[model samples]
Every structure is written in structure tokens, then in C-alpha cells.
Target: MSRPVVGYAPGAYDMFHIGHLRVLERARSECDLLIAGVATDAVVLSAKAKHPVIPFEQRLEIVSSIRYVDQAIADPHVDKYLTWQRIGFHVLFKGDDWRGTERAHEMESKLESVGVGIVYFPYTGDVSTTLLRTRLSVSE
Candidate 1:
């Protein structure tokens, strides 16, 4: 029999929102198992230059509780290849926002070389943690 399709969806997932849920749900639908990688505070700080509004532990807990996520773990690496080496997922799920970027292209090349595929879900443009933070700051 063919191996099960395992998908990895990595994100900071700060300030959990419906958009995040939708991505995870859609990712789960496409794969037999969905692993949500919750970026740690240090990883978020290094990647986005800002710490998450929610604590890493809390964010992890929230993601772990999601019905669509079969597993949740701290994603400490900035390099997707490293995560793949560790997790060995058959596919990677990401927002379409990264679809055409340089980083995404690099990632696509690397992942494809290793027999892994990437699936980009439609980006939820209406809301995001960055927008929420900006709104909060403006109101404050």
C-alpha cells in the first residue's frame, strides 16, 4: 500500500483567529495527517523581528487543541528544509501569500528536490495578527 500523506503547516499562530483555523482545516482535508508547527517566541522574533502577542506555550496549546491538527510541535527552525529533515512530511501547506516570493521559490526547489510538494491555500486577506496588532496599537 502507498504511504499516508502527511502535511506540515508551520506558523506562528499568534492571536488565534478564524483564518488560522481555516488553513488548518483545509490542510487536513488534503492530507491524511496534518502537523501544525507552532513557531516558538525566539523563532518568531528572529523571523518577523517581533515577538508573538501570545506566549509560545499558549499558542502551542491553542494549536494543539484544534480539531484539524493531528499533531502540534514547536517549530524552532527558520529553514523549512531542516524542519522537513526532522518531520519527514510528504507535503508542506502554506498560505498563498508566500506562493510567489523569493523565499517560497527557494523552498519549492529544495522541497521538490527531496520528493516533497507544497500546497498553498488561499490567503485570508481580511484578517491577520499583524493587522490586529496594528489596530490595537492605533487604538491604544
Candidate 2:
């Protein structure tokens, strides 16, 4: 039997919420297997230069527990192309919030060369971890 299409999504996945669920739900629908890259705290800090409310280990555990995700892996580096190549994934999925931007457009071009496609799902604008954090701060 042929292996089912696998979709990979990489993120810090901290303080999981509706946005995270939406991405995973859409990814699962596009492919039989959905693999997630739970960015380590070190990686998140390197990019954002701030500590995540939830630590890497906790975030990894949270994402792994989600039923939609078939597998969760640590992503210490932010190299999207390399991760997709290493995992041999046929598609890389991300939120459309980054769509049409120079960086994402460039990435799309690069991935197309190697026969892998970049799929962008609609981004949930109103609800996000950032918004949740802000609300919590106000409540406190």
C-alpha cells in the first residue's frame, strides 16, 4: 500500500489555543498524517528574544496530546526548507497570515523547485496566543 500524504507544520506551539487547533485541523484534512514541529524554548527565544509563557517541554507535550497530530518533533532550528527536506514531507503547511509576503513568496518559489508545495490555510485573526496573553494580563 502507498503511504498517505503527510503534512508538516512547525511552530513554537506555546499556550495552545483556537488558532493552533485550526492549523492542525486543516492540515489533518489535507493529509492522512499530520506532523508538527514543536519549536524548542531555545529556538523561540532566539527568534523572539523573549521567554514563552510555557516552556518547550510543556509545549511539546501539549501539542503531542492533540488527536489531530500524528507525530510531534522538536525543531531547534528555523530552517523551513531543511526541515521539509529532512522529513521527506510532500507538503509544508503554514497560516496564510504570512502569504504573499516577500519571505514566504521566496520560500514558495524555492520549494516548488523541489516538487514540494507550501500550503497556506486561513489565519484566525481575532484569537491568538498573543491576544490571549494580553487578555490575561488585563484580567490580572
Candidate 3:
């Protein structure tokens, strides 16, 4: 029997929106099981240089409750290979915006070498937490 495909979709998931749901839905459709990794506040701060609008625990809770996510876990590492080592996922799901970046290339190389594949979903160009934040700030 073939092994079940375990997919991992990691994100900060702050200020949850339809775009996040669509990615999770698509990721779930392609895999037998979808594991969503919610980046902790510290991880977000370190990577993005700004604190998440929502707290880590709250963000985790929000992602965990998504119907498309079979499992939700805290993602504390900036390097996806480290997360792969810990989670042992068969595939990684990400937004296509990362498709051509250096970090994406590096991650693809490392994960592919270990027999893990990456699936880039079409990014929801109309919405994002950054855009929301910017709009809110401008209105205030």
C-alpha cells in the first residue's frame, strides 16, 4: 500500500483571512493529511522584524480550528529544513510568491534532497495581513 501523503503548510497566520483558508483548502485537497504550522510571535518578529498583530497562542488557536488543517503546531524555526526534520512531512505547501526567491530555492534544494517536495499554491494577491495592517494604519 502506498504511504499517506502528509503535507505541511507553515505560516504566521495572523489576522486570519480568506486567502489563508483557500491555501489550507487547496493544500488539504492535495494531501491525505494537512498539517498547518503556525509561526510563533517570536519567530515572526525575528523573521519579519515586526510583531504579529495577534498573539502567538491566539494565532495557533485560529489555525488549529480551520477545517482544512488536520493538525496545527507551533513553528519556531526560520529554516524550513529544521522543521522538516522535526515533522517529517512528505510535501511542503507554500504561496507562489516565494517560488523564485533565494530562500525558497534553498528550501527546495534541502527538502528535495531529503525526498520532500514543495507545492506552491497561487498566491491570493488581493489580500494579506501586511496590506490589512497598512490600511488600518493609514485610516488611523
Best by TM-score: 3
lDDT per residue for candidate 2 within 1-140, as digits (tens), equals 99789888888887899899989988999998899999888888886686799988889999999999999999877667777777878898999988988868777887788888789998899987778888999999
Where's the lowest-lDDT run of ten residues in candidate 2? 77-86
Q: Clashes in model 2: which pairs?
A: none
Worst 10 residues of 3 by lDDT: 40-49
What is the TM-score (0 to 1) of candidate 3?
0.98
Q: Which stretches of candidate 1 lie over 4 Å from their true place?
A: none
Candidate 1, residues 1-140: lDDT per residue as tens digits? 98899999999999999899999999999999999999999999998999889999999999999999999999998889999999999999999998988989999999999999999999899998989999999999
TM-score of each: 0.97, 0.90, 0.98
User: Which model is ahead, 1 or 2, in terms of TM-score?
Assistant: 1
- Please identify model 2 stretches exceeding 4 Å from their true place: none
lDDT per model vs. reference: 0.95, 0.86, 0.95
lDDT of 3: 0.95
Clashing pairs in 1: none
Report residue 30 deviation for candidate 3 (angstroms): 0.4
